[model samples]
Target: MSHPQAKTHRMSEFTESIGTVTFSGIPNEGFLALGMRNYWDGYFAGRAAPLGLAPAEVVHAVFYNFADGEVARHIPWVWGKTTPEEAIAVRERGSAAALRQMIGDLADSSGLARAADLATRAAVSAPIEGRALYAGLRALAVPEEPVARLWHAATLLREHRGDGHNIALAAHGIGGTEAHVLCALAHGMRPEEFGRIHHLPKPQLAAVIDGLRDRGLVNAAGGFTDTGRATRERIETLTDELAAPAYDVLSVAELDELIAGLEPICAAVDAAGD
Candidate 1:
């Protein structure tokens, strides 16, 4: 027999799920989002240098999972020791190599510039000032260079989507600790690592996991139950829903043209894995 508490917990999650999905913008946004995100991820990863970009520079910029830029919590967990002022400098300069690394290969392909120009135009058409994540990124001034503007625009769009994800997770009572825990497990990481990355105390992380288990989302073994996986999937679907207005500036054909333009560049970047 199901416990009364379990049933109550599920009901709460289901209610939040509805509230979360209701906030999604529209359907058109998802069609191009993955490609745009992948493009930025690859381009940025190439910024590594001697005091160069690490995971921490933008971790808090894109996410509120740490409440603020709590770089110490996650940075040392991955990099062990960090140099003084590196984080501050990255925010200022943004790894000077970013433009060179990402733009060189694109020089041979005009599509990259064309797609970026289109995306930059579309990104600005949306009502983004009120969205917290987008607002944070938008507050940063874009450089004069075309590719730099493109990167900033892409980052703005990405953070806009991230804000929606945050909303969905909160609606379901999944705070930073709970969300990170499930995601870490889904990615085959240990619970201790999850705690360090998100700066959760072990007792608190364990408590969140226990709560998820009661709701039938997390297994005792730190893996996802079918319920857990299903919930994560639904939240992501809703995130795209809320992210739709950003793409409303383009017609389906226009978006298709943009995505088509980006495909080869993204594939090449993906293969390089830098």
Candidate 2:
């Protein structure tokens, strides 16, 4: 038997898995076709488009975890390369294409349609206050196509939960770099490796790790101490609690249907290695 809160607990994992695949996978081809030359270029441009050529400071504030000035290097520059409407258009198209390619015949299933509907409801119903990314995405029209609709819904819920996570991180007094270190330690990743993924410089990463160690959040082996592990768990648990409202819009039965409906689609995407 499953834990009573298993469905609720898995909401973030499920939404993030599908949403990131849609965000970073085959759709990247569309970004490249749009003339973006690198991952950071497309990432800053595509995700930040909804904020309408936002300045680096604003993007940095909302994104919350990027290395200092990392967002500044791309934001308005990407806006010059592609309009928000155009970026959003290709995002939907690319996601639709990726989903179709990954799922093949399952693209047209009625279950997907129902899942889309349930997911859409959850996304739309999530509170907008303080959720900049989620609010911006929710403003756009939901896609008419089922696959695109599911992807969009996933993206919306993903952003919704991400915004909540930022809030949780902030309340716990964790800074961006420190948060990355804690996350790495918690996940058994080397803090340097995780920081490098976000383009943090070696000096900055070393400084962050040192600070964490001073606080006893990290040990000599670059792993979390008991307090560090507990802190990360607290932040994650709080994030899940904050994310609860979105899923609350659905009943237990509806939530199960949506999860069951998307599980195979997620599996297919995983199998395709995209």
Candidate 3:
């Protein structure tokens, strides 16, 4: 089932790291414009519409993008003079504006063309499937520009993997709260960062931690115990296994090409940080 070019390496580890960073590092985007545009673009492209109501947008975005509480905490800092609800409302308006804005902004930004090409390279290997995760992402209208096309493709692949991850999380008996807690602990993110960004309650988080300790899944130092590490490993394995179809068509050589192309772009994006 594996692509001949796709050698057996740490595909799961790699995809996890790259996909997580690619999406998670949006805050470090060139500026508000870069950040918002990519956020909105992914928002718009990731789903199919009859776009839901404003409140619905809030619910979906908060669930997927940030911990709702995280949005609440950072609203004053990131968006300024805004509430979490207000921020969601702004995005709900019309993604068209986001698309229009990012297109122009991206044009002026340096090294986008190279990044776009890299995305395209990876995208070529992502085969289509009958599921909405694949179909909806493919449904997005590709822009004429190389950069926009590349961005959309990369977003598509990222979401495709994300859809699979959600399934993997559910199969392991982890709920939203525990899932967030585990991710924070395993990733070495500060509890404050995870709780605020994910909208998790401090008390609930403490309770989860206590429960995890009782199960020998976490330690007093907020790090994973041996069992906890094993659990994390299992979750990652399932996620990557689920995501394998996208890369199944890609040869090891092809995957290597994408990784090579991605390096410079990653550096460029990092350099554009605030």
Candidate 1, residues 204-234, lDDT tens digits: the string is 6677779889999988776899989999878
Report every candidate's CA lDDT: 0.52, 0.82, 0.51
When 1 and 3 are scored with TM-score, the better candidate is: 1
Among the numbered candidates, top TM-score falls to 2
The TM-score of predicted model 1 comes to: 0.62
How many clashing residue pairs appear in each of the predictions shown? 4, 0, 11
What would the per-residue lDDT of candidate 3 be over residues 1-274, giving only the tens digit for each residue? 4643233224433333333333332322322342434453333222322122224434344245344353333332333333333333332222223332334455444455554555554555565553345554465445556544555555556656666666667677665566777888777885557743344567866877788788888888878899988887797777666666666555566666666655554444444432
Pairs in clash, predicted candidate 2: none
The order by descending TM-score is 2, 1, 3
Order by lDDT, highest first: 2, 1, 3
Which wins on TM-score, candidate 1 or candidate 2? Answer: 2
| Superior candidate under lDDT, 1 versus 2 | 2
